[model samples]
Target: MKFFSRLSIQSKLMLMLLAVSIASILVISYVGYTSGKEAILENIYYQITELRNSRARQVQSYFNYVQNHAITLAEDPTVIEATVSFTDSFNQLENEEVSSNMISELWRFYEKEFIPRLQMNVDGNPTVLSYFPKENIARYLQYHYLVKNPYDVDNKSRLDMAQDGSKYSEIHQNFHKFFRSITTRFDYRNLFLVDSETGNIVYSVHKDTGFATSFKDGPYAYSGAANLFETLQNNRERGAFEVIDFTSFRPSYGQPVAFIGSPIFQQSNLVGILLLQLPVNEINRIMTGNFQWKKDGLGKTGETILVGSDYLMRSQSRFLVENPDTYFKELKKQNISDRIIQRIKENNSPILLQEVKTNSIEKALKGEEGLGILDDYRGVSSLVAYAPLKLSDNLDWVILSKIYVSEAFEPIQIFGKRVLVTSAILVPIVTILSLFLSRRLVMPIYRLISGTKKITSGQSNVVVTVPSDDEFCQLAGAFNKMARTIDEEKEALEEQIRKNDALLLKTLPAPIVKRLKQGEEKIADKFPHVTVLSANIVGFDEQCDLMSAEEAVGLLNDIISAFDDAAQRHDVEKISTVGTSYLAASGLFVPRLDRDKAVIELGLEMLRIVRAFSQEKHLKFEIRIGIYSGEVIGGLLGKQKFIYNLIGNTAKVARFLMIVNSVEGKPNSILISQNLYEPLQEFYQFFKMGEIDIPSQGKMAVWLLSDGSHKK
Candidate 1:
């Protein structure tokens, strides 16, 4: 204490200020680092969770599409007639006899062609007679479609006529093209017509050994086809569809296969079953995102998988497909069955073969949707997002979007390193700032107070001076005048600044305005993660034609004001309004984890606003809103009359969607692209509206917002 007293005033002040500034900076940096860590974790959780929800929606949407189409085909008039005619003809051939030469050729075909392909896929030997169609009618039909057909096994569906001079041939010829088209167009493995009465598969589009076999008493009676037939018999509800989980379908050479079956009803009477062989390729494509995992924002070591309630994988793992050595090494550590692991290796896939047992999988299997840092199936610590697919109770498929914990938190680790380096660099800088501020700021106030004391004692020509350039210098310059009217003048200046700020804010975002005031000429910023919403008001011009100019302007003002309020409420920044179009964006001034969600909410609210305005004010106007998310450049355009504007393909796509939806969609349509839907499916209800091809942006899938609910 005595040594400090010996120092000069500026040195004493510097020491004290340096100590205070150091302590404050240390405390603030610690708090900021801890809070920033948590904030980053939350963002990572949200990112993976959004990906998981997107994959779940994709799976559910695809199944729903196939289900609706299956039911439609079942109810088609042509299909109904084909079922009646084919069953009658199939039954009539129960006593039909085949010559000895034809029987020999059938056996030869199965032994030489079928079994070779079959054994190439399956481990054990499967007998031909076990899968052979039973009864004379089945044998006769198989001989024509399978053995005697001119096309190979894959191309057998091309044979429309057997040329055996039978009614079955004529029936097959009439309807074979239509059924074959379904398989080709939709990428189905096969299509089957099963007689509802006898449980016999009377016809098949791609005739395999299972063709013309009876689901009731055939050798392969316990197959997915039989399971589907029994399910339809148990449930007679309209539009009921029975889906069989993936199994080793022997008819397809023990390859994994799933089934989708709907009952064919001819005027309220069950005639036949319409069965579609759900191609695993299509399901895999949806689950794996066509093997473009990185494009979906899943970083290195990140993958999305589907697991059934049985704890077996329903989709292939990214590591297994891309890096088999590491995948198998991890599996070995878990003590999994060698045979099962070997089988997966032989098949080069994990679907229905590899077991995925973990806490995340268990939670998802229980129909829970959430995210956490947990050990995954491979026993690696992972950041995971889990959810149950809402396709059906029977499927009970769970989806997981995950990345290795090390990779997910890699950014945080980098931030921590940067903090350490920054702390080291900031100590010296803080010392300088503290010493400069103490000398420049403190002595001026002290001298000013001392001079005021002299003035109070009736002294004349006493001036307290500060040489530094700042607000304090202005105070020193007008010291005499400031003492009398400081409060009034300060208030007046603040009011003027407030008016200017409001005018600037009305035209530009707060962040942009701040940059302009800070001497940043040609103000510009690149926002990589923002969502843009473009909305168009329809019938407004026609309504304005009937009204006077003042009334039309007033109506537009009311709508724009309401929109501005909605944008504020939803945390969206209004960019511009041109004629009947209003444009907005999110994650510009302030970053948000829910940028897509906020913009979607704003778009929906704007639609509601327009609807209410039309009804409340008796106007016949309509609104269509569209949203797209991507990178954007925001900057001033014009020299004098410029406002902060967003320019990018994102805005272009949004405008196109708005215009397209206005023409073809409902009066108030809110359409979001696949990019936006992927992140918000868990929170919003969306209806897939097919694809729209833009001029420069190619084809994009669009979903219509349903029920105006975009929040959980």
Candidate 2:
């Protein structure tokens, strides 16, 4: 007590300042830490939610594509006519003597060969024939035998006869070709045409155990195939499609399978069903991005899973794909059913085929979309973003994008630790400095405070000059040095930013580049009435082969650069250049009513530019230009090596026009589709070249741009 009473005024002031400084630092640190943590967590949650929604949209688009394809197939004239003809023929033969003999032979084979195989494989289940009456089975067998044998005199081997032009053989061959093409083009597991009236499987691309079988009352009547036919019968809408969940498809040897079926109608009358075996690989690619988690911005512990309303996964699992052994161990640890585990072990099928019950799945199935921290199916703590996906009336699937909570919040945890350590170290240093400064800091403190105020007010050149030979002067000098260094670094950073902006401008349009620099994550736009021009230098490939690598590259660059100058002159946006092909468009980022005119002018200028360059280099160069006017969607693709690209039927048709109409000798041939000609017919002179047949688009009128100088 006596020592405290004898303390000097300076000592008391130092203690007070030290205490106040430490208290302020603690309060500010606590507030900053809490606010920063909350903000980071909120950002992460939003990012995951957006990712989940994006994936859901992609899945929906895939399903829409499948539905549209199925509808188109069902509406095909050949499919409708063939189904009706086949049904009529089968009905007419029902009362024939030959049909009776074929039925008797089939019944004998069924008893001796089919039932034994069915019993051996399906555990002697009586349900195989429970719904099938003997008469119905006999009728179905008769139809199968006739179609398969075609011209068998004696009901012996059902091998195809060498009758090249038999009606039966022609019908069989046409149906086989149609089914094979569909299967190959779409990469489907199988394609089936089921008779609507008889419920018999008429044709299949890959005929397995279920081939030539009746779905109505046959051995496989209780499967998804039967259910799909029933659903189509109940729904008579033209474009309606029915989806079946993944199950052990008997035809594919117990491999997990799903189906999509659309009704085939002939003149508004139900004829048959066009069924496509849904390819799981396509869905997996959409869900997990081909198992490329890192490319998808999902780091080590992140994955996206799809769950159907039945609690089964609709897509493959990352854990299973990356580490099957670890997945098996985890499944066993989670106490999955022995039956499912055994199936997985024996067949090496996806774990998604097994039921998965988790909090996220339960919520999503109940039409809930949210983000939360919960235990996933593997009983691991995870941060999950989940949404309900209503692909169609029959498909009630859910998408879950999840990552380990530890990984999701790892950055926050690290930052919090760093802040805590910094505060702990800084608080003591600040207190010690406060005490020391309070002892001799009067003059230097005033000088530093004045100079710091000026610096904070945007005066980077402020210098604190403390002439005293003490620590205060040294501290002032250090402050001035830091200010100068910060000024230099600021200038350097601005220069780097300028360079980045210029580089970005070269890759993307100016407006899009500005938006991206302002932190726009995604850039995409849909232009309803845009004109796309695709120009390719004819014989460029041959020319490259003849010239040296450097010469070829230099020549290509010069040609593309000339085209770029023409595009800029006409206000047309250059989309991209690949090899010798230059793709440009009008009304893409910026909308203009005269987009077609702009594109035409650009195409003509490009022809002139190429001709001049060819004359200058003494090289024989010819250019073909194709322009099509329609809707298009453009966007930036890929995170690394990103490119701004365009897609749609318009882009495809334009490129096709260029390739199909281009000739080697023609120096400047500009082919325009009917769509483009319709709008510009009055403004430009185009010589009609008659109708040209285009795949998918059918026959269309085409014209050659003759005189671009004439304008209406």
Q: Report the C-alpha lDDT of model 2 over 1-712, residue by residue, as the tens digit.
A: 6775687655666667867877787777678777776776677677778778888888888878888888998999987887776555445434434356655565554454445444432323533344223454334533354334554322212232214233444565556666676777787888877888878776666645465567787766888878988899788878778888776565454566788899999888888988898868888887788778888877877788788888887788888778888888988898886666666666555534567788888888898888889898788998889989987777788898888888877777787788788878977887778677775657677777888888678776778888787887789889989878877876787789899887776667777788777887798888898899998988777767778999999988888878887788899998888888889999987889999989998988888878877788777777898888889988888797667788988888888888766852145878888888888888888877778777678999988874344566
TM-score versus the correct structure, for each prediction = 0.55, 0.50
User: Positional deviation of 651 in candidate 1, in angstroms?
Assistant: 99
Assess the local accuracy of residue 459 in candidate 2 as a C-alpha lDDT between 0 and 100.
Answer: 70
lDDT per residue (tens digit) for residues 1-712 in model 1: 9999998677888888888877787787778777876886788788888888788788888889999989999998999999999999999887788877877788888888878777755667867776655577777888888888899887888898997889999999999999999899998999989999888888889888888888889866898778888889778766788888888787787778888999998888999999999878887888778999888777778888888888888888899888999989988898877877887787788877788888988887777888888988888899888888857767778888888888877877787788778867887887788778777767776777787786667455666678788877777767755544544555677798899888788777888778888988888788888888999999999999888999999999899989989899988999988888898999877888988888877877787888888998798998898888888888887887767788878878888888888887777878888888887889988888899897687898998984456555
Give Cα distance to truth, residue 486, candidate 2, Å.
55
Highest TM-score model number: 1
Q: Distance (Å) between predicted and true CA of 191, model 1?
A: 1.2
- Return the TM-score for candidate 1, rounded to 2 decimals: 0.55
